[model samples]
Target: MISLPEDQPRRISEGERDAGVRRLQEAYAEGHLSHEEMDGLLQQALTAATHGQLARALASLPAEDAGTTSAIGAVSGRILRRGVWRVPRVLKVESALGRVQLDLSRAVFEHPVVDIELHLGTGRAKITVPRDAVVDIEGLRAGWKDTLYRPRRGAGSGGPTIRISGAMGMGRLKVRHARR
Candidate 1:
């Protein structure tokens, strides 16, 4: 039994349990855990009654994936990533005649610095980051409109640093703070 500090147990919601299960699945797919280990963890996650128990079940897993990932938006399509998704160390986003939105407000970042390489072609791309994160936009070529807004204080030293680069042809790229 997991011990709680205040003796008052906090109920674990279904969403939280599902998220834990997804993380375990990802770990298993990435070869980070064996099939037996994943089965055990999934059982614990499904039966976890309290927040503390759920946290204990997921405590041994890594915060994010071990390597980089790429998300592509093809022509006339949309690609969106939000909610409690994991942010990779290096993310490559490409959109051609489509829209792409990456919201990192509720994301989990394992790396201190996240590099995003964008390749937009006649499409719109928006990246919404946390207020505390440091955003650096560079190497934006011509024919692209930049609507990135930053705070006066800049990113905190301890916060994650997001470095955005690459080219956008006749496209719009915007980066702003998350509302929440």
Candidate 2:
């Protein structure tokens, strides 16, 4: 017997929901998502209207390769790489070891404010912006130098203002901008 709602979303199977949760978890653990972004994306995944939507959401998971391939019905069954995250280009980074690596090296942030909040253990960080770019670091355990906020000349003349906040336990954060 096939029972489905006429208008609203159909209930997804436990397998689909579980898979979605796994995907969401992987994104966060990989630093691919900021706290808020993770919340939003996970919320969407959990509340997805249907199984189709849930599947789509999890389909874009980053490729994980290693001795990571396991045979499931003559096909791979691994849902995630051991540590690979499917993160977007623009993002907020957080870590417990205080290690935040950002490659803004190629991204010309057109926005006015680029805010970053990091929670870490050792606090090692870096950022590359346009030379004209301005950076404001607050709520951090170390001073400005600990964060190598550099701007690449004219490239930063009208670039965005990048802000970073770090927790005491954080590690190093590295940011590299795109080369001209």
Candidate 3:
């Protein structure tokens, strides 16, 4: 066995801790950890003082995927995305006075967690997710109508997690799970 010299513990920065927290959230969304477990890990990550502590908080998580982000913007027209499309890990959608529809029931999800940030203005947006998908729209802010979404009862059937955020101006968002 090789003998190693004792070294000082490296302190982690706030950004590192924040990244750990994000990883925990993704793990929780993917059903890899229960809510309580995620909460505990989140607390640990938030209070982590060293790199080892932060690493422990993020331990046992799935390997990070090399996913891509794409942005879609439209002005005064209809933006529709259906058929067999590849869903990016992060999607930024911006529309001005245009209707937007994204049907992901038949789309390919390359990542375990996906984030969709929408910045809409005076347009209606409809999103169709897979039946087994887990969606969290708590970060979305609507200036007009309340979002139309029915939460799925019980646990999910194990699919990707979609996190939607950003602002909607004078628009209504309707999210529905796809039906067979």
Candidate 4:
């Protein structure tokens, strides 16, 4: 039996390789990579013995295709998104008499700029982002008694840019950095 290294990179499995290959194919189909380049990356992904190698094989591909997601939190309910999930380019969140939380510290973002449209109706929404991420809240509109607390850091610098917009009526919206 052929044994692989126990290192983190070597722990990559065949499923990961397949996923990398699929990403390369998608990049090729989207015209980001040529047929020859796709084939070469596909070969590298297939033979990748480590996670690092697999990552390098698909590094040139775009993080996310152009897509959007709509999340709704109903009355007396909670909606949360956390962990190492893929983030959509555009996210629409609506909360009514409930709480909605989106944690992006460990998420894999698909785009460098994430556009978030939030509608809070007598509800609360909290967004936790990475410390290095840039946040823009210029488009936020709040009603009387509606409050919004953002990170201390200014926008237009650092890693990804999260553009937050929309309205809050008798609700609260907070954007804070995740604790390292």
After TM-score superposition, what is the CA distance of residue 69 in candidate 1 from its true location, in Å? 3.6
Tens digits of lDDT, candidate 3, 45-86: 999999999888888788777589999999889989999999
* RMSD of each predicted structure: 13.6, 18.0, 12.0, 14.4
Clashing pairs in 4: none
Model 3 segments more than 4 A misplaced: 1-57, 60-63
Q: Rate the local accuracy (lDDT) of all candidates.
A: 0.76, 0.51, 0.86, 0.75
Error of 4 at 46 (Å): 36
- Among all candidates shown, the one with the greatest lDDT: 3
Model 4 root-mean-square deviation: 14.4
Deviation of model 3 at 52, angstroms: 13
Per-residue C-alpha lDDT of model 4 across residues 32-112, encoded as one tens digit per residue: 998898888888888889888888888888775666675555665887899888888788888777788899999987666
Could you give candidate 2's per-residue lDDT for residues 1-180 as a string of tens digits? 675577656665443455467667877899877888777778778778687788666665665322121111111111111123322322444443333344453554433445555554454555554444455554555533454445444443444556666553434445455454
From the highest lDDT down, the ranking of the candidates is: 3, 1, 4, 2
State TM-scores per candidate. Answer: 0.58, 0.37, 0.67, 0.59
Model 4 worst lDDT window (10 residues)? 7-16
What is candidate 1's local distance difference test score? 0.76
TM-score of 1: 0.58
C-alpha lDDT (0 to 100) for residue 172 of candidate 3? 96
Candidate 3 vs. truth: CA RMSD?
12.0
